[model samples]
Target: METVRTIDLLLDAFGRIPPLLADAVRGLDRAALLWRPEVDGRQGNSIGWLAWHLARQEDTQVAALVGGEEVWRAGGWHARSGVPYDEAAMGYGMTTDEVGRFDVTDGEVLIAYYDAVHARTVEVIARMSDADLARIVDRSWDPPVTAAVRLVSVVDDAAQHVGQAAYLRGLLGGPEAD
Candidate 1:
């Protein structure tokens, strides 16, 4: 069997995430896009939050292992989202109430955040040599993680949350792409 290259795997994962998220956003009025489900007793992450969280996760991963501060940390979005920042400006994953304080009402804010995340992902990944992937980096929680693993985690989580946003959009009777 042919061994798939690391870049190929990363791109494959990256390719699957955005369309789903875009689909979820397409045709959504501001209200429906931000609507939280009540019946499911869900914490109800709006599409905005999903986008914000995905970008924040990417920023953290890239910053933690790849070097540089997270974009959201520097931008004050985390605090705007009610998340407290570390001295270095990393988020500890704030509560829903804190997240509620975020100004998610603006579609442009979320879109811009995602755009930056995408650009940053490309910029960071382009600089990573194979040896760079093997270097160990300390994570904010639990155990130290490798650059490779963290990269995969960002891709996987982005896809998962995009699917979730898609599902939530569907539940709100929004039009999905054919």
Candidate 2:
């Protein structure tokens, strides 16, 4: 039996996220994309916010690994998104108010941004070598983090957010959801 290369496995896992994200926001209007289950609570995230965060996360992490510029900046997504936030904000450590402030309401734009970031991720993964994967990318952790581990973490985080987006879509009762 031929063992699958690690890069192939990572690529396969990463490939699944974008389509799920697309389906989650498909056919959703601006209201639906921005809807939150609780107007005064922090129990849920809007579909638009979740999609943006996930794309930013993947874009930043993968760009760091590959030593390339993020698609958010290089692809002119900030201006195109008209998100009213800085280019560097990736939804990490964001307060409830800040999350609420993310006002990207166009589902098509959100999906397009995600698709662009995902394409960059796929390109980086395709070009990674065994040595690159084994190289340590971060040393702040106790055991240190390798490129392979960082890639896996990125994929895992993306999968969770995409799943959350899909759940929100179902909760909001979209036509193409569920």
Shift in Å, residue 163, candidate 1: 1.2
- TM-score per model over all chains: 0.76, 0.94
Please provide, for model 1 over 1-178, each residue's C-alpha lDDT reduced to its tens digit, 9 standing for 90 to 100. Answer: 9997786677667766655666667555567656776655646677766766776777777776666877775766545444333424322466766555444545555666666667778778777788888777756757677788888887888877777777777677623423
Best by TM-score: 2
Which residue ranges in model 1 land beyond 4 Å of their true spot? 1-3, 40-43, 73-92, 139-144, 174-178
Which residue segments of model 2 deviate by more than 4 Å? Answer: 174-178
Q: In lDDT terms, which candidate is top?
A: 2
Query: Relative to the unseen true structure, what is the C-alpha lDDT of residue 129 in candidate 2, on a scale of 0 to 100?
Result: 95
Scanning candidate 1 in windows of ten residues, the lowest lDDT window is 83-92
Q: Candidate 2 residues 1-178, lDDT tens each?
A: 9989999999999999988998998788888888877756554678889999999999999888878899999999998987868989999998878887878738898999999998888888899899999999999997999999999999999999999888888887535555
Model 1 vs. true fold: TM: 0.76
Compared with the true structure, all predictions reach lDDT values of 0.66, 0.88
